[model samples]
Target: MDETEELIALCARALVAQMGDVPGVEMALTRNGVLGLTGAPSPDFNRLTLGAGPQAEDFLISSVGRARARGLPLVVVMSPQAQAALAPVAAGLGLTVAGTSPLMVLRPETPVTPSRPVKITRALGVELVAIAGDLEAAAFDEPRDAIARYFDVCLTETAGVEAWIAWDGDLPISAVTVTPTGDTAGISLMATPPEHQRKGWGRALLTQVMADYRSRGVARFHLGSTEAGLRLYESVGFVTVANLSAWLLPAEGALPGRDRGGPS
Candidate 1:
């Protein structure tokens, strides 16, 4: 409703467009392998949908019904107006709702202006490897070949949100992506393997991710995070700047997948 909220909404819409076209885990198709307009084909569980829209209203109702009927956690994000309209629809279907409003965390030009006390330094071996279609592995139960081919279709259609694998050894444990938003970077789909978490994998990965972007003169960092991630980002020098939350959860509800690192 305010200026900041408007900015968040704009950023989220941009990300949805970017991620939806990619049709990766976060933007996967359903289990039935239904041919989405994108033709990338994801599991029904990994549906990529628009926020509540006039054209998408009936489709959202159907999605909410499907989620309730199947007991799967169906995720939908949209504008505030669309969210409000879908409220009754969600409630009508007995679906639990939550929303992790998107927020912008700005980095000051002079982050090191005033020197602090002893800085907490840790040994973090971080590298940003750019791959055209690195890890398109099946997020659900599909075979690797099928998922990769499907993802390739999405990658071809998308102009933003290229994949980046964060690796420690030969194996990639953590992964996150950035979708271009004009001059800004909208970070999305961050994940770490279950066995690899709590070892600062996410922290280290995010640190390097931002550092890489900053070096390129990327101004504002845009992202939508769960509540748990708020604290994590704050520790990494991110400030609460805007709200792009949808009706995925309650206003005070926790963000999703703060604990589960890999492939949500």
Candidate 2:
């Protein structure tokens, strides 16, 4: 992989490292570029990402079998480069394409200037993280505790991530997380409640966060975005670098071809 793609993969690795830190979560990093995280509160957390590698097919089968053994719903994620070959393989294993997300990146030289002035705060303690989690859950319409379980891990100082929140007085209004990996930083879990949409709070929060990181001598930032979030990310000078394909198993039971053991 080239430098930009390698940076993207590093961000992903950093993210899974954070997920693995949460109490009982199990993580597997395979030599063939498959990453599995199981036993989290949601299937999204229990994901297996397939990166570009020569033994990807065999690696994927083994990874899925492991998740099956754990009896957890699994979501498989693949980069654009990996999807063309793996999509059919994923289907044969009883998985179907769920959605696609754009991988976006921003270099330090690009300016991120929010249209309005706003105050933002860093989440310090467990209480603040929980509050930020609540805001995130509300924004995404996900179960609060499921999201909080992951957010809480950000409190670990060496986890390479920092959580930030924007408040409306006592109410936590917006939340974002930045994971700094060497010279590049990955932005994730940015949220603002539906009621507060179009108010430019997202812009303000993102700008401030990027500015803070840039001041610290980190220039590059990257993230994956849903279609709904594309415009907002684009407004902040982020451009799409890749489209990641995601697949999910039919249900939480046995995988289709598990009996036909795969090559490790």
Assess every candidate by TM-score: 0.55, 0.89
Off by over 4 Å in 1: 1-5, 12-74, 78-86, 89-95, 99-104, 107-158, 241-264
Alpha-carbon RMSD, each predicted model: 9.9, 4.2
Query: Model 1, 94: alpha-carbon shift in Å?
Result: 6.2
Those runs of model 2 whose alpha carbons end farther than 4 Å from true positions after fitting are 31-34, 255-264
Report the C-alpha lDDT of model 2 over 21-53, residue by residue, as the tens digit.
666666667643545453653567677767767
Per-model CA lDDT versus the true structure = 0.47, 0.74
Candidate 1 per-residue lDDT, tens place, 1-264, comes to: 553544444455544554454332332232211112222222322342344335445666555444333333444554455556666775665445455465646554524111222122211222222222333242223455543443333343244555455565556666666665655676755655456667776677666666666778776676666675677667666676644334331212223433221232
Clashes of each: 20, 0
* Residue 109 of model 2, lDDT score: 76
